[model samples]
Target: MTTSPLRRNTLKLSLLTLILMGFVLSGCSGEGESWNGKDISGLMPGLEFELTDGQGRPVTADQFDGKIKLLYFGFTSCPDVCPTTLQKLGQATESLPTEAQDDVLTLFISVDPERDSPERLAAYVDFFGNGIVGLTGKESQLRQLAKRYRTTFGYEEPDENGNYAVSHSSAVYVFDREGKARLLIRPDLGVEEIRQDLIALAKADT
Candidate 1:
């Protein structure tokens, strides 16, 4: 049977689409890479920051260049989300193989500097785990970092007790060893799923 011109054109287009899809699938399965969280590679810039650690020392992203870092922003006074997320992260990192445990670090940055002083921040992070580092800075510094990650925080009005709540992003931003953004872990992800993603990213070639 002879094919019409329109039929031939349609067949050619379909073949081209299949070829393109093959390339996409190949890319997805490359190096056996897989992530349970949102893959954000190249969607954001590499980690960069200048803040104070829990020990009252100045710190920058360069200090963590060779470690897989999880960046989270929330206040210490956060009634639920902050503590819950930190506990999950602590458990996840602790579950890693002893030799690989040190390869992961969690940066818990407090958005409420007014209430979370350096000393308080240090104690708060210590409650989570040793691998967790609590960092905070001036409001300006926190603002800039949040903007870099495309997240923000705001304060609610204080009650008669003069206590207020701060609202911020609950997702954890994961960065590879070289500090490039890689995955975004939602608050709803299980600890095991988070652990697997961290292991894969840590084992990936820098």
Candidate 2:
């Protein structure tokens, strides 16, 4: 007995749907592949700004023209959030392929320039990893950079012991090769999620 034409067409449609579903699942399952760091393309097409590095050197957005940049704002004295986030970023960078690694830059900018001097900032960043750059400058300059990035930070008064805490935004801003802001990752995100987003932005064609 032969199958009816209607039944045959129904089977064909069902098979096609199954194939499509498989493709979608495969893409989602291999999200890790995007974290390899070579996939950010056209994410942040073009943007430019100037800020100081931990060493007091003038670091401009142009310096990162051909690479993906992870920009974070916090003071050196940040007791918890800053260090934790930076460490996670270090891990994500380590997980990238070498070629992609070379194209990645992580910048830590001090919002409390009154206390976080260039030397102090440099030392703080160096403790994390090699590719991480620390940045601090005049209060005015630092404030300008923070404003451009829409990051806010403030320092609490010191206690009787002359120690205080700095409270600041903990979002990691991802910029494409051209310096445009592409995505923002909060400190609470999983390391894997951060890695995957970075990889996807890196693979973009900007």
Candidate 3:
């Protein structure tokens, strides 16, 4: 028996999601990976980009190079996953001691520039709280940035009612103070585990 192309793609996506989800679940158990995250250091450290932030200011690597950055790609219209992930991140950092939480930054970059304006991004991200920056840019700029991380995202074809989902990565990419890519935080990671990881990074020597 052979699988149709569409079916094969769907199956592959399902498997990938399950595998990533398992990693998140195991990692959140406190019995799993260390608070430092599953070190991916020195690998794919090419996390650099300049985009317009929600406030209409240029956001560049230099501006954030000395702090730990948690980067996520998603859009505002996502029904569940996007908001949940952002909320989890916010909750994870909210109760940390001021110093620890202050040293870390979360960046939510929209993949749906076609409909996600800076104002829209601001509203979505602000709901989470401070220390989180909402960013969006020209579609070309976004693609280049995503390419650097080997992450893929794009708008799906609209149905008759013009509804569509923007296919995007949900994993959180963590970078150390030195700006080296350190960990890829999965969605299934609990708020506690995520908080500890950020605190660990925040408290480290600058």
Q: What's the alpha carbon RMSD for model 2? A: 16.7
RMSD of each: 13.5, 16.7, 4.6
- Is 2 or 3 the stronger prediction by TM-score? 3
Q: Output the TM-score of candidate 1.
A: 0.84
TM-score order of candidates, top first = 1, 3, 2
TM-score of 2: 0.73
Better of 1 and 2 by TM-score: 1
lDDT tens digits, residue span 1-206, model 3:
97654455445555655665555556453543366455555456556888999988888876887778889988999999899999988888787887677778889999888888889999889998988999999999998987777665756567798877776777889988777877788767898888887876666644
Any residue pairs clashing in model 1, and if so which? none
* lDDT per model vs. reference: 0.83, 0.69, 0.78
- The predicted structure with the larger lDDT, 1 or 3, is 1
5-34: candidate 1 lDDT, tens digit per residue: 445544554554355334334445334467
